[model samples]
Target: MLEKIKRRIEKHQAQPIGEQRTFAVFLPLVKVDEEWHVLYEVRSNHISQPGETSFPGGAVEEGESFEEAAVRETMEELNVSKESIEVYGEIDFIFNQSHHIRCFVGELKHINPDQLQPNEEVASVFTIPLRYLKENEPEYHTVTLKTEYNHDFPFELISNGKKYKFGKRKHKVPFYRLPNQFLWGFTADFTHRFIEIISEDTNFLEGKNEK
Candidate 1:
């Protein structure tokens, strides 16, 4: 298995660049009554990003590849066997300043949501139909993050006792509203792009599945 994975990596010619805080997520899709749906997890209140909806995943650990991390995290959180997951391929990489996320898509085989056990990091599991995402557009909201500095004596040496301009950073946040549920932030960003890619490749807007 390791040899096969090594060949696949070599085929893609992928390499890690520098030292980055990396994360990986699996976009698990399942068939529900002839329609494809995307699964999501609501983070536990005790964990980071509490109550936020995201795909099953976690940080990439030492000696583990991005794909390995994705599978491991999904298994740990959802308590599903690795054999049940069929990883298709990576969709895209999301870069947010210093860190980045490796996004992958896959199908979960014979999954019973009611029977699945969630760990402490997961509050509940839910699904969003692919048709909904392909049809509806996310609400775009922009905000600027201003830099804050402490009052210290070092400002005089750098700016010659004059006030220096510190620029603010702007970001466009995506929000997808589905019934009573709302998906925003990095989760929404990845999902939005995934929908676009599949839509274009498969003519999803015309109600066709990917070949």
Candidate 2:
């Protein structure tokens, strides 16, 4: 079943598409223990997107394809060579107000936590069980604005923060919870969607009694 998914992704990658956009690859390290685990990273405070939790990936450079960028970023960030990764497939593409995200999934045959190079853009690295994410229910909230258009945004979860209210109007600064990780903004959205797709596939295969 994983092979089938991989073939479909390769076909998509091979097709030529115009209007190329900035793409990123997210390598989700899955551990096969009593339960499945997925790796995550905390962004370094020095970076613009600081304290944010995300997978190891960045913008695709000029003349670089999505796969190349993914492989390169993974090697640089995790210090894990390309040969150690077994590309499985890709997750759904997530588009934010700022950028378009192209995500891919690969397996790590071996991992040495000590060898991980968390640069100025990355603070720390960690892993959490997949079941924790699958069971958590997210709460979405919105805020209205008096801009060109009245916009209401959705925030998955909230933390202990200030909630401001106007005359019949209110805005809440919320923080999203990802079990052991905290996710927000584009990275959060991308990871959430990726997990949803993988979980669905796993469930479908389980129902069919396929290994």
Top TM-score: which candidate number? 1
Could you give candidate 1's per-residue lDDT for residues 39-137 as a string of tens digits?
A: 999999989989889999989998999999999999999999999989999988887556789989998889977577989999998888898888887
lDDT of each: 0.87, 0.67
Candidate 2 lDDT, tens digit per residue, 1-211?
9999988888884633455468787656656553455677887888767877778888899889887888788777777778877778887786644557788887766665546675667789887666665565345566764423134432223343234232344443334575666866556555566667766776633533232
Error of 1 at 189 (Å): 0.3
**What TM-score number comes out for model 2?**
0.66
Q: After superposition, how far is residue 164 of candidate 2 from its true place, in Å?
A: 27
Clashing pairs in 2: none
Show model 1 residue runs off by greater than 4 Å: 1-20, 160-162
Q: Which ten residues in a row have the lowest lDDT in candidate 2?
A: 147-156
